[model samples]
Target: MFLTPAERIADYQARGWWEEIGVDALLRQAVAERGATLALVDPLNRKTLDGCAPERLSWNELDARVDAMAAALIALGLERDDVICAQLPNTVDAVILFLAVARLGLIISPIVMQYREHELGHILSLTDARAFVTVPTFHGHDYAAMAAALIAERPGMMLLTMGAAPHGADLRALAASADPASVAPWCAAHPVAGGEVLTICWTSGTEARPKGVPRDHNHWVLNAKVIVWGTGMQPGDVLLNPFPLVNIASIGGLMLPWLEVRGTMVLHHPFDLSVFLKQIEAEHVTYTIAPPAVLTALLKQPQIAASVDLSSLRAIGSGSAPLTPWLIEGWAETHGIEICNIFGSNEGMALMSSPIDVPDRTERAHYFPRFGAEGVDWDSPVSAVMRTRLVDPETGAIITEPGRPGEMHISGGTVISGYWRSPELNGASFDGEWFRTGDLFEIAGDGALSRFYRFVGRSKEIIVRGGVNISPAEIDELLVSLPGVREAASVGIPDSDLGERIAVAVVVDDGITPPDVAAVGAHLAAAGVAVFKRPERLVVLSALPRNAMNKVVRADLRAAVLAALES
Candidate 1:
C-alpha cells in the first residue's frame, strides 16, 4: 500500500512542497472550521441522471454522510488496503463515497460511467477489488445488473448500489442502518498515513487493457496544491466541476482543490451546457473548468452566453491544447473571465497557464509556466519544486532551446513513482527519477517569456475527444477483429466543436463483403465499445498504407479519411 519511497517522501516533506496531512485530514479540517458552510452539491438534473433529487450539503452534512458510509463499509467486513471500484455520476453521493474510502484507509479506483463490461472486467482483475459501488441505473444503463454479473464471476466480491438493487447490497440502506458515531474509533485505530495509496485511477495508452495509476495521499494533495497556488483560490470560493471526477482533470484539479479552499463544490458531468451555466449563476461560482471546444462553441452564440450571469467568476480552466489565442481573449473581453490553460495527466505531469504568470492573454492561451527552471522565478508554488527537461525522443539528448519539440521529462514532489503493479510498464515509463510524459512540448518565448512551456502535440497516438483520452490502438485492434476486415487504422479528425472525432479506415479482404459505416458502427456497439470511442466516419480502402514494418501508417490513413469525409 506504501507506493512512495521513504527517502523521496522525506525529501519532499523537507523541501516544504508536500504537506503531512492527507485528504482525510483536509476534509476533517474543513468540517471543523466550515461546518455550517455549503460544501457539496448534486447536479441540477440529478433526478433525470440518477433518479434522485438534487442535494446541497454543508460541511457537517457531508462529514456525517462520509462517516455513515465508512461505518457501513466496516460493518460489511471491508478492511484497510482494500480496493473499491466506483462507477457513478458526479453527485454529492459520489464525493461522499470518495471520502468514506479515504477515511477507512481504502483505495478507490473510480471509472467513468461510460465504461461497460469491456472496461470493468479488466479493472476488477487488475485491482482484485473487494467491492464495486455505483447506482442501480445511470442514463438508462443497467449498472446494477452489470455489477451483479461482474461480481458473480469473482466470488466474495460484493456489489453496493446507490439505489435499490434486486441482486446486490443497497448502499443507502446500509448507511441508514449504521451509526455514524461508531466510525471514529475505527478510523483512529486504522490511522491512514499520507504515503499510503489512496486511489488507483486507470489510464489507457497503446495497451488494450487500461493501466492503473496509483496515487498516495500526499501525491494527490500535492497535485491539488498546484491548482490552488496557480488559481489563487481562497476560502469559500465556489467551484463548478464539469469533468468526470475519475481522473486528474476533475479530482486533482477541482475536487481536492475544493477541499483545500473549503469551498462549495458544484458537480456536473459535462455536455449539459444550459444546466452548467445555470449552476454557475445559481451558486455564484467563483471558478470552474470546461473543455475548450465547448467554451468556444458557447462563445460563438452570444445570446446563449449572455443568458447567464458569470460576474462572480474570475477565472476558468481548460485543459491542454485546442486553445486558440482568440478564444482566450474573447471570453476576457466579452465577460471579464480569464481562461487558464492547464497541462496535466493522471501520471502527475502538472503545468498551468494562469493570468498572473503570462499576463498576456494571447500567450496564456498556448503556454504553461515552466516549473523548476533555474534563475527564472514564477509566482506559483509548484514552480519551486518541479524539474522539467525536454529530451529528444530518438537521441536522448536534452533540448533547452525554443522551437524544438521533444518528449517531456518531469520530476517533482507529486509525480508518481510508477504505475500500479506493472513492472514492464514501470520500466518503460520511468527513466530513473523522471516520468516520461509522452506528450511533446516546446520551450517558447524570449527573456521572461522563455520560462513558459508550449504544448505542440503528443508522441502517443491517443485520440482526445471532448477531453477524454481514447487509445487508437484499442479501436484499431477491435476493428481488425471483426469479420472481413484485414487491416484497420483509427485516427483523430480535427473538429471545430469537439476538439477531435474518431475516423476509421478499413481494408477488407478480397471477395469479402465490405462493411459500410453503419455496419462498422453496429460491430463496435455489439462489442460493448463506448459510444464516444466509436467512429464518426468510416472509409473503405483497397489497401492501407504501411511502412517496411507492415504497421498501418495512421498518418496516411488520417489524410485519406479526412479527404473522403470532406468530399
Candidate 2:
C-alpha cells in the first residue's frame, strides 16, 4: 500500500499533479519554489503592475508582503473566519490582498469591478464582510461612491481604498510601512487549518438566487494543482488572462497554475484587441483565455495581418461564451495556433482540453471529457488524474452503456464538496461523491470524448419547441457569427404551433441593423443551422445586459422577448 500510494502520487506529480497543498501551503510553496522568479508581469505599466521597472519579486519578497498585509488586517481587529470583500480589477493590490487574507485565514470574497449599489449590497450583506477594499474610480464609475453606499447599509464594515483615498476610507499608505517580519510571526501564530473556508464564490443566478460557494484552503490548492496538470502547464510559460482576477477562471486558470509551475503571467486590465495582441508579442505569452467576442474582434483588426508576430503563442483557450467551430478552424488555419475550449461552472466541476487533445476544429468546437476515465475500468490503467462519468439526468443514476446521453459528473481531487452555507443544494450538487456537473453530454463508444457535448442548455432556459429541446447557447453561437452582428443572445418566446419560438436579441455593429426576418432566416440557412433552431424574430439592442460578473442576464432577456411578442 505504501509503495502503491507513493507510485500513484509520483505518477500524478510527473504529470504536474498534486494531492492538496491547501491555500496556506500553496502560497508557502510558491514562495519556496522560485522566490526570485517573476510570478506576475503587466506590460501596460511596469511600475504599477510590478511595483517598479524590472519589478520582480523573489519568494522572500512575496512572502514578506503577504505577511505585512496579514498582520495589518489582524491589527485592524480582523479575526479568523471573518470575511473581507474586495471590489477591484486585475491589479497588484488585489493579488496582495488575497495572499494577505489567506495568511490570516480570513475568507476573501472578491466581486467584479462593474458591480454597482444593488449587486454590491447583496454580496456584502450576504457575506457580512467585515472589511471592504476598492479603487477610488475605474473606467467611468465611482468605486468610492458604490462602496460608500454599501457601507452606509452595513455601518460596522471597514472600508479600504486603492489608488486614491476617499473621505470615509483608510488609505493603503500604512500597509507599506508595516513590518513583514512581524506578519510572518503572526501567520505562524494563526496557521490556516486544512478545512477552513478561504473564499466565497457566487453562483450565476440565472434561474434562482445566487448561492455563496465556500471553498477552503485544501480544496482550492488541490483544485489548482489538478488544473495545472490537466491543462499541461509548465514553468517559464507566460499566461495571458483577460478575465478579471475575481472570477473562477482567474483562480484556476492563472493564479494557481502559474504559482505551482513558477511561470510568468501577463495580466491585462481589460480586453482591448490591440493591447492584448501587443502584450502577447512583447511578453512572449504561451497561453491565454479570452471570450469568443475578443477573438472575433481580433480577427477583424487589419493590423493583425502585418504587425503581430504571434509565434510565441502555443495554445489559446476560450469560455464564458460558446465558441463556434468556424472560429476555431479559422484561427488555427490562419495563425497555426491551437484553439481549445473549456466547460466549467462554479459548482466545482470543470473539463479542460489540451492542444494535443483537441488538434482539429471539430474537437475545439465540441469535445468534453467523459466521466470515469479511470474508476470505470480497473483492468486498464489510466494516467489522467481526473475522472468523469455520464449519468441519467432525472434519476441521477449512473449510465453504464455507451451511446446514451446524460449529465456529466466528475470526481477527482479538484471537485469541491459542497456550496457554502447551502445545505439544500448539497444533495442536488453531488452523486455519492462526484460533483454533479449541470452540463448534459453523451460519451462516445471508444472512451474518447467528442469535441461537442450538447449543452442541452440551462435547466430552466431550455426551449421546448414542439417538445424538442433547443439550447439557447446553440442558437446564440450561430446568431453572433452573422455579418454586422457584434453579439447575440437568444430566448424562447411563446408560440402556438411550437411550444416556444426562438427570439434573438442582438447588438449590431456600427452602421448595421437587422434586415428583415426573411433576411435573417436566409443567413441562418446559409450557415447550415436547422430551420427550427433559427430565430423567428430579431430585436436590436444597444448592448446585451450583463450582471456584475459580465454574465448575460438571460432571464431578463427572456422576459423582454416575451413582452416584445405581446406588444
Candidate 3:
C-alpha cells in the first residue's frame, strides 16, 4: 500500500532521513523505556462528547489496549492493508484505534466528526474502506447512525462505534472482551514497514470537493521532526492537543512528536475554554497548538487569561490564519510563552517559525525560516534535507526576487508524492517530484533574515481590484489587529467598474461598542494600506460563514456581502 517508489524509499533511507521502521516500532520503544509514564489522557468532557466516561492510559496500558483493539479488528475480518475509516472525537479510543490499525499494517482514513453523509459517502466510495469507526452521538449529532447509513451504501463495510450502538459492533466492548495480548503473534508475523501508507487525510475543501492526501509512515515521522526541533520538545514533556487528529496539524505536530519524545499527550475537545485551562493547569502541559481565534480572545480579555497559571507552557503553535503581531508579542511579554507560527498543508508542506529560528515576536508572527531553498539557509536541520522554490504561477518560471509573490513548490522526505487516486490533481499539483502548494508567499527578509518566507494569501483567494492585485489575507490581518475587530474575513465582490472590490465582514467583541464603519476606514488609512486594497464595502455581522473545518468560506461570504449591498 506504499505509494512511494522503491528508489525514493531507498534514497531517503540511505540519506538517513527515513527509516525502515513503522509507527508500531516507535510505540514499542516508548513502551519498553517508559512503560510507567503517562502516555495518553482523554478529553476532560469526554462523557459530554460521547456517552461514556473518560479514560487515561500509561504507555504499558496503551500498548496492551492497542493489541486488544487490533485483535478485535482482526476478528471482524479486517486484514493487513485494509482501509479503516474513522470519524471519532478527540478521545483516548481514537488514538488507540489508530495505533492498533497501524500495528497491523492497515491504512486509516480519519475524517472530522463534523462531516456528515455527503463527505462520508464520497470517502467511502473512493477508499473502499473495510471498517468504519465512530461514536453513536456527539454534540447532539448521531454520527454512528450516519456511519451506519453510509456503510449500508457500501456492502461488506463493517461499522465499529466507540459507544453503545444499535447500528454496528461496539468497538469498546469488543476490545474489552478480547485478550490484551491476542494480536501479538499476528503483528510479529506480519511485520510492518515505515514506507507503507498509514493514513489518507482529506483536504478542507472550502471551495470544492475534498481531495485525499496519502503519506507513508516515514514521511509523517520526518514531518514530525519540524515540530520536535522547533518547539524543543524533550522526553516526558506534556503536550495538550486540541487540533483534530484527522489531519496533519495533530498527526505530525502533536501525535508523532509526542511519540518521538516519549511524552504525555493530553487531548482536548476543540475550543473548550474551561476544559483547556483546567487541563493546562492540572496536567502541567508544556506545549500545545491553539486556534487563531482563541488566541486572539485571550489577548483581548486579560482577566480570563490571568486567571490561569500559564508558566508551564514553553511554546504554542498556531496556524490556519494569520496572527496579529500583537498576539505573538502579547503571549511572549505577558506569559513568557513563545508562540510558534506553523505553516503546513495536508499535502506535505512543512514550514515552522520558532523562537530558535525566528526569535523576534513580530518576525515570528509573519516570517517562516525558508527551509529547503537555495542561497537561503536556516539553523534547523530540515533545511539541509528539503528543497523549496517559488515560481510565478503564470510564467512557470522560478521566482528569486524578494517581495514578488509566487506559488511555493517543495520536494523532500516530508512531501507526499501525489494525492490518493486523483490523476487530475496529481497532474496539476506535481512538477516531477515537487508538490505545488497553491499558497502564495514572497521572500521577506534582509541580511541573515533574508532567508524567510512571508505568506501573502492563497492564490485562489487573491482579490484583483481594477488592475492591482490585492491579498485579502493581508487586509484581514490588518483589520484584525485594530481594536474592536474580533473575527474578520475579506472577500472579493464583483463590481461593474472594477473586476472585483474588497469587502470585509467583521464580528466585534462582546459587550464592546462596535467600531463605526468610518473608524474602520480611518484605521486602514493610518496603516498605509493602498486605496485599491482598502475595503470598498464593510458589514458588521454577528458571525462569519465558516466551513466544517472552521475555515471562512469566502464564496459564501462574497454572496452574503453582495446580497446585503443589493438590498
Candidate 4:
C-alpha cells in the first residue's frame, strides 16, 4: 500500500519537500532542456558483461528507450498498478525497465542480484507479480532455468528474459517490436500520480526475512533532495556509481541526483577498484559513493593512489560502518577529496556529515548534526523537512544529555509509513509517526541548539561482559586505527565465567603480520580504551564478509569466530 496519507501529502507539497511533478515529468524536463547530453554511461557492459562496446545514452536516446519499453509493457496487457519483478544487474536494460514501469503506472519491484531460489520465491509469491524480468544467465547462474522452474509453480506469471527467451518472452524483442509513436499516447492515457507506489524494494534481511518497502514518487523525490542538499551536489556533475540499483543508495544517492542535476552517470556493476578508479580518471567523475572499508583499502595502496588521476573528484560519500578518522582525513589531505560520512537505511532514515557542514575531519567521522535541531538550522533543503530524536531504550525518555546512548527515531517526508503488506512488522517498526531506527546514538555537543548526535552501534549488537555493556563500535573504531589493520569488527563470544567475552575479527593488510590479542589490548590501552571494553579474543582473516551492499555482516563474523574457537 502507498504510505503517504492525503493530509501528509498536502503538507509536504506545501512545504516544498515534494513537488507536484512526478519522476517521469522530471526526466521529460531533462530531455526538453539537455536532450543531447550524456545521461548514462555503462562501461562494465563493454569490458565484462556483453563483450560489446561500452553503452552511452543521451537524454533523448534514453527517453526513446523508456517509451519503447513502456509501449511494449502496455501491449503485453500489463496495465496501471500491475506488478513487475525485475531481477537484473546494473545495466541499461534495468534503467529502461524502471522508467517504463513508472511511465506505465506499474509497480516495479527490483530484486538484488544475490537473491537465490528461496528469497526470490518468497518475493514472487508475496507480490504475485504479473511479469518477471531477468537475464538468461548472470555470474554463471542459469537464471533462465531458474525462471522456468519458478513459473512452473505459478503458471500465470509471465517471464521476460534479457539475453535469451529460453524460459519465456524475450524483452529485447518486445522492446524492438513496440511503435515509439504510440508510446506517448499510451503513457498519457495511463498517467501515474506522484503519490502512487512506484517501487517495492526488499530490505537486506540481516536479522529476519526481508520486508518489502513500498516507496512513492514523492518519497523518492524527497530522498533525492536530501542527498543532493546533504552532499552539496551541483548541476551537470559527473557521478561514478558502483552501488547496486535495488536500494535507496542508488535511487536517491545516484539516480535521483543525476535526474535532478541533469548530469552524467557512469555505472559500474560488481565493484572492481582498478576499474572504478579508471572510470573516475577517464570520465572526470565529480562525486561517487563508497563504503568506508573500500575507501580505507584504496587509501592504503600507494601504487593505486599514484596511478589514478583523481583530480576531478570533489567528494566521496561513505558509511554503513564506523568511519575511521584516519581514513577520512587521509583522503582529504592526500587526494584533495572530501569524504562525506553518510548514514542511511532502506527505511528512509538519513544522517550525513558533509565537508561543507562539518569541516573538522575528526568531527565528521563521529557526529551528524541532527537535522532540524531546535533553534539551529543549516542551509540544507532537508533541514526543515526531517526531524530526529534520541530516546532511552529502557525508560522511553527523550535523551537530551551527552554521552548517553539512545535509539534513534526519525520522521519526515522521506520516511515510509510502514513495511509493505506486513501488518506485524508495521506495528513494531513505528512509534506514532517516527520510525524506530534500531540504531543506537548518543547526543553530543552542548546547549539545546548546538547539540548533535553520534552513532553508537546497534542496540542488539552491544557486547555484555559479566554485567558491563560494551559497544563493539567503540572497540572497532579504536582497533581500526592500528598500523596494519585494514578492517575490524568486534563481537561477543560465549564465555562460561563472564557469560560472554569480547572478540574481534580483523582483515590485516597484505604483507603485514596481524597483531596478537595482547598487542591489540596494549594498543587499546594506549588509546585510553577501558580494559572491560577491550577485545579478549582475536581472529585474523584475509577479508571481512560483506553483503551485496558492501556492509560487513557481523552475524557472519560472529559465527566465523565461534567456529574458529570451537576448532
Best by lDDT: 1
Residue-level lDDT for 452 in candidate 4: 69
Give per-residue CA lDDT, model 2, range 348-439, as digits (tens): 56666445444556765766544235344321111244677777977867766656778777765455666665666777676655776666
Which digits, one per residue and each the tens of the lDDT, describe model 1 over residues 1-567? 798888888888999877866799999999999998899998888888877899999999999899999989999999999999999888888898999999999999999888888778889988999999998987778999988998999998999999788878899889989988879999879888888999999888766667899999998888777888887787889999987679998899899999999989999864588999998999999999887877887888889989989899999988745688899999999999998888888888878878877779888887877887655677677788788888999999988788899998899877899998899989988998899988898888678668888888878778878777888888887887777888888889887767788888888777888777788788888887778888888887777888999886777878888887888
Between which residue pairs do clashes occur in model 1? none
Q: What is the Cα-based lDDT of residue 362 in candidate 4?
A: 87
- The TM-score, computed over Cα atoms with residue i paired to residue i, of candidate 1 is 0.97
> lDDT tens digits, residues 463-533, model 3?
75532345666667677777877888788887644556778888887787776667777887776443445
Query: Candidate 1's error at 437, in angstroms?
Result: 0.8
Model 4, span 1-567: residue lDDT tens: 356688878887898878856788778888898999899998654546643466899999999999889878978888788889998878788888988887777899998776666567878998899999988887777877887788889978999987664688888788888887877787777777788888999773223345788989888877877888899999999998886678888887898888888888998888788889999999999999987667877778767778989999999998766677898889988989999988887778788999888888988998887886555577766678888888899999988777889999998888888788888877877886799888888877577424568887666665655423456665666777887888888888866446479898888767889888998888876764445667888988777878999876777888998887778
lDDT of 4: 0.80
Best by TM-score: 1
Instruction: Evaluate residue 561 in candidate 4 and report its C-alpha lDDT on the 0 to 100 scale.
Output: 89
lDDT of every predicted structure (CA atoms): 0.86, 0.66, 0.82, 0.80
RMSD of each: 1.5, 10.7, 10.4, 10.8
Instruction: State model 3's lDDT.
Output: 0.82
Model 4, residue 348: C-alpha shift (Å): 0.6
Report lDDT (Cα) of residue 325, candidate 1: 88
Better candidate number, 3 or 4, judged by TM-score: 3
When sorted by lDDT, best at the front, the candidate numbers are: 1, 3, 4, 2
